[model samples]
Target: MKDSAVAPTRVDGYAELRDYAVIGDGRSVALIACDGAVDWLSWPDLDSPTLFAAVLDQARGGRFDLRPKVPYTAARRYLPGTNVLETTFTTASGTVRVTDALTLSDTASLTPGRELVRRIEGLAGSVPMGWSVQPRFTYGAHAPHLTRRAGVPVATYGAEAVAICAWHAGQPQCTTDSVTARFRTEVGTRALIALPYAYQEPLVLPTHAECEARLDHTAAAWRQWSDERTYTGPWREAVLRSALALKLLVFAPSGAVAAAATCSLPEELGGERNWDYRFSWIRDSAFTLDAFLKLGCAPEATSYLWWLMHASQLTHPRLHVLYRLSGGTRAPERTLPLSGYRGSSPVRVGNAAAGQLQLDTYGELLQTAWLYTTAGHRLDADVARRLAEIADFICTTWRQLDAGIWEVRSAPEHFTQSKMMCWITLDRALDLAVRQLIPARHADRWHEERQAVADFVETRCFSERMNSYVRSAGSDDVDASLLLGLLHGYRPSDDRRMSGTVSAVEKTLRQGPYVNRYLGPDGLSGSEGAFLACSFWLAEALARCGRTEEAVSLMDQLVALGNDVGLYGEEIDPASGAFLGNLPQGLTHLALISAACAIGEAAR
Candidate 1:
């Protein structure tokens, strides 16, 4: 086995997970360090046990660090139309190029044989490069034993086997870790490193030319798919980046889209609101469908709805707010013992709030269902029945308190958002029933309940004291979600009440330019950064309300909050406007695409 050129040098923890850029195969993803470490990756699939978990804990989280032996600043980008990641490190000595990608299986087979190909090419002066491979299984708890087979280093952990090898043009033996390799690259020198999952006898290694060809094909595939996007707008690049991010989150084989790639990144860093977002959410799906449709990305919408079709068939008493990526219904929550990112304690894996009764989901589901059916797709009878049953359930349960949109753990109250969603459920159901001329068994009843709910929002949700819609009845605090009331077709955007609510939200919940969901104390202890999705919602609502100029400015600012590659998290710090929370968030991208399309169309 070859060793890294230099001993492992810690990065002093300066690189936060937020600073990392993402690259992924359609099946799984890897988070690469700005300095060139493949820090976080899962094997076999997105939800599989981690082969590199260093992001959660630098010491125990197995990391595959490949970079110059000397200090260097790196620049990275994804090759057009592909998940291939290329990082160029500029050092005092010279420049070295590293490319990373997961190889596609050429034949029909399944095993722990996922290959992570990394190629290093010398572009300038001679530079030394290093490699470290540590396999931490089960979220950094178990360490694997390393051995050499046929002169190639392979790490074995339980049922998984990861092979690693390096080839450099005319370079002799360097140093070695159990799996690490070291070498030097000068001008005109090229080296290739491959990590292949081996299931058969003597895993055959692809030649350098074969690797290059595969990389080219992958790039072509991505560009071709991206070219299908017909969005021509002011924020075209940002929208494109967001669309790409959404594509990355999709677990292609299963047609399941995760809400976000990683879990528990924290809404407020070090706060208790940290929860897993790697699972698929019903609401996320509905919203994502509408967003994708707007961008002319119909395949994602069709695929997701099909996934929802199967998911809805589960025999549970009610649908979960979210589900596992592989369509698994069981997501029992457990805490990992290791310290979390930046000491954010209680690192959790499975989501516990999946069973919560979020009344708002009905509105989203029905609204998107209506969208698909209106677009000439036939409604599944089972889907329609289940949907109507949910509407009826909301009709009966709307008056009762449940967890609101934020999934707050406090004993449920009559959250105005929940009530408004109840209104939506009835509104869309009645609309669909009317369009199809089908008997809405309780059309009049649903209409009456919907109006009653609307009236409830007017009377109880709005506060006379602030002259704006409050978070809920008897509370003076404003909620940003009220902005959706107008956008969701509950009221005309020009309605005075909505205008007043928007102004009130601006005055109270708006931190500088960004918006917070609520001004009231969330039961959690720490303060949170401004919610980016809420700010984007404000932009969309403003556009719908005919405040196009203000909406455009706000949208520009929100787009600027994205990282260099055009990804955003849940929140942004008002001070520096830096992104926070689990990054490449589904909600954030969905909002960007929808806002861009709405603004783009309105402008035209």
Candidate 2:
């Protein structure tokens, strides 16, 4: 092996949003560009401040770079049935394979500390590879001090420390801010790099062989987890990949599923729609429960239910739309000082939507509770009582104006989707009560309110002009969320009204093959990209409405829209086919899985 130090090559601008793949260790996730740059990472935990923020602001944000010194064409994929990412770089002279993963322990559990492992193997002639390891703490707000511990590079920022160890034939040149290494490898040679983070603790460097073994175990664990999934249907690969992505969003300690790994990745480029999604949203609990339950993962549902129960206790069973992973409610929204992702200014840290009164959350929470009980998971007395109280709250407060399901910042309105969900809240609660899943304290009252909500939606929300259900009372605008009426049984897919609503949505909200949330003003200045999840919802609606061929075609298009590694962002630009918003979005994966499952069921 030949060793030398090379000056780091600066990344000129941001990589395309779709050009990154994600790897995680249950606790945190990292986004790696196709060019082998680990650009965005939040270590120790998913919601923690970024340790590497290069993906957001390429010029000032920090990153870890690893790639060939010469020009190369790249192809990447996740190892089958696992989240281990493998990228093959082929140059005119040689080819190399890079494997990336967050290391797991022997039992296939997240390692006690933050550990990222990268392995490279030469497949052809000799190739020169360059790597730079730089640490920027606290979302690039803190510059760490670098030192060597037992010959390994250590980066310390206040109480947090990360140690980097390498196993190769090349020596690394280390500075106070970064470590750079360049090496030439021949056929059959391999190299390894490991970085582990600890909070105010001495670094324990793992041997290269030990790190390699850990990688093998981690892959095995992921494969075993994937193998347990019961979705052996059409688009099994897509479904499994989505399931893996959703699993990555699960913060194992608390079982709170984050909305996405990275915050402030913009829904529209150069727009203010950037918002942090590292926290769990109560509104997502129903969709997440449906996805996980369908994929044969009951433990996640149980854990989530426990978290919900515990979190409800904090606020006296009054649920908010979102909460921190640790069950804290104070996620004050604030803009960071750094320039946003690709000049999308005002990078927001916490989500202000947490305080919004989205009445749909009552329906979502009750629906999740119903799902939990139906899945053979027993709810304790306290949990049952808390759920009952939630339903009671919905009964009394369903008529209040709310921010609706979309969490619009505008004045409250009687959104049709929210009304339908209020109906679902009572409907699911009544169903569970009938089965003695919980005490039917207000069954009669819930029944009356459920019917009242249905009547209100039918009489007030439907528009004869649009020949379909509208976004709100007295409004003629169709929302993509109306597609969810089919899933929630608010309307039969074959009903003429449902058919009309579907047609209206297609006419108004559909843009080519994608679907926007709504065409109306959302109280935001710039327009948002097509919501990927809503597009999936449209596919599901089509499948349920007996348009099998059209649904399959649409589903195929939506599935193919995913990035190379089968991950999707929150939104997509319809014309450019560029991913937008926070990436590897849980809602997108959940919707994809749900739509595929619907299509599979329809086919059968």
Candidate 3:
């Protein structure tokens, strides 16, 4: 809700991550900077090549700019319970309000496959406004061929097209790679702009009336979805906002929730720790399924589990660390030529962690299935067979080193979290067999191996001097991820070892509400900010341990950490309070939801 009259503060032409809010239409999302620029958007789908990525490269990445020509300070918020954002600008001349949304499709008209609608209204004296559309295709690698469809300006690249339909605004004049316009608004004036997009199909050049109706309908639809949410807990506002943010990351067509909206957002300024988080991770499975069921998103919960099984069939019984939104297995890491956000170079597109051997994934998947079945959802015969086989696979695979939950690039090691999750995998498998959800012929072997895994974790992972479980087999350092060992029932909250581990994590890895992933080397050259998800995990662990007052105090601070629009990024710089990674981060929101629910339950 802040920006100076001239502009939002920018360093090297990049707005602060916290100064951005996101809007989406299930299929795609747009990152609109506080100063009113749509800086990042991947068209047609969440994981597709960018149509606007100024967040990645200021000079080459395209954007849609809209703001008052005269200097104006701005304040913004989501329009009630909806994702639609309303921004108000106050200049000396007058005040103006703008509504922004990636409009949802409607059956009342020939709606677009994808559409971004912006509405502007003048409330006081005259205010001059300006807008421009700079269309760059294929991650800013291709300049679109600009033309006109009937009276509207159109940008085309191969089979993809975008037609700009505007009314009561200025005449759009096309330049080489952009279209610009200028206009003035008096009291009670209204204007609208719509970008109707097409992919491998004919463009839908929407009418002004249809665009206006669609915008209204989209807002109503969002409100309806929000009203249906069942979470009636403390911090309901933040929890619901996180749920909306999570919805944006869900690829609606496939039911796979993406890890984040944009890619290559740096974990540290001018650092090589930048990564692409567009794919869904196996580690988020348990929490995602849990949150969906808790929020009464039953359809999403079912599709998510079905999507998980369907996507991993290609690599059956062996889960990749992550999978593409469309259920694809491969994500070959590649870099773009453009300079990254704020000069963080090698802007990457794909995730290399997809190929890593993360033993924690097996436990996460099995836990998800267990949760699903416990919620009264049935696993079919085929999926039941695969779950049993995966448990069997873990029996032998748990002995190998793994990249672990954080996906560290360092040489694989026997991470303590990975070993604990291996134990969870077999324990859940034996439970499923006892429930007769899966075959019990191999239950005896699973039980024996589960004990072996438990023995290894208890004896080797616990540090006698530290009175806590170490990050790896023998190290004394504490890791924030160790908190999951308690959350997932690896150990009860009353267990002295678990309590000591929580204490060690707080002592070694926390400063106030901020929590570092680990203090040790991650095999990367540059350091990263505190992981936001870990901080939320600590809040949940505290609540589970019956430290309700402390949990509430910590959560109060953490909830305030969200930016004005109640959105969180992947990480935060504790020293500066600057968001440090890809925005609308799924894991951070998932952790927030999980923490809020746990704390609410404990307080009750």
Report the Cα lDDT for residue 568, model 1: 81
Q: Model 3, 1-604: lDDT tens per residue?
A: 2223434678888999998999998889999988899999899899999999999998999999998898888888998789999888888899888999999878977778899999999999999999999999999999989998797899999989999888998999999999989998889999998999999988989888998898999899999999999999999999999999999898999999999998999999999998999999999999999999999999999999999999988898899999999999889999999899999978999999998999999999999999999999898999999999999999889999999999999999999999999999999999999999988788999999999999999999999899999999888878898999999989999999999999999999999999999997889988999999999999999999999999999999999999888999999999899999998999999999999999999999
lDDT of candidate model 2 versus the reference:
0.86
lDDT of 2 by residue, 1-604 (tens): 0112222233357888888899998999999988899999897789998889998877667899999999887888888999999888888789888999997778443443778999999999988999998889999887779888888888888879888788893687888688889987789999998888887666667778778999888899999999999988888888999999999999999999999999999888889999999999887888899888999998887888888778768886567888898888989999888888888978999989988988888888888888877778888888777777888888889889999888998899999999888888889889988998888978999899889999999999998877899999888788988877778777788898999999998988887779999987878889888999998899899899998888899998888888877899999998899899998999999999989999989989
After superposition, which runs of candidate 3 have C-alpha atoms over 4 Å from their true positions?
A: 1-7
TM-score for predicted model 2 compared with the true structure: 0.96
- By lDDT, highest first, what's the ranking? 3, 2, 1
Error of 1 at 325 (Å): 1.5
Q: Model 2: which residue pairs collide? A: none
For each candidate in turn, the TM-score is: 0.92, 0.96, 0.99
How close is each model in CA RMSD to the real structure?
A: 4.2, 3.6, 1.3
The sequence of per-residue lDDT tens digits that candidate 1 reaches over residues 328-430 is 7888888887666666667788887887888777677777787777766767676777667766777777787778788777677778877887798898889
The C-alpha lDDT values of all candidates are 0.74, 0.86, 0.92
At residue 503, what lDDT does model 2 achieve? 90
- For each of the candidates, give the backbone clash count: 11, 0, 0
The TM-score leader among the candidates is: 3
- Position 461, candidate 1: lDDT: 88
Q: Rank the candidates by TM-score, best first.
A: 3, 2, 1
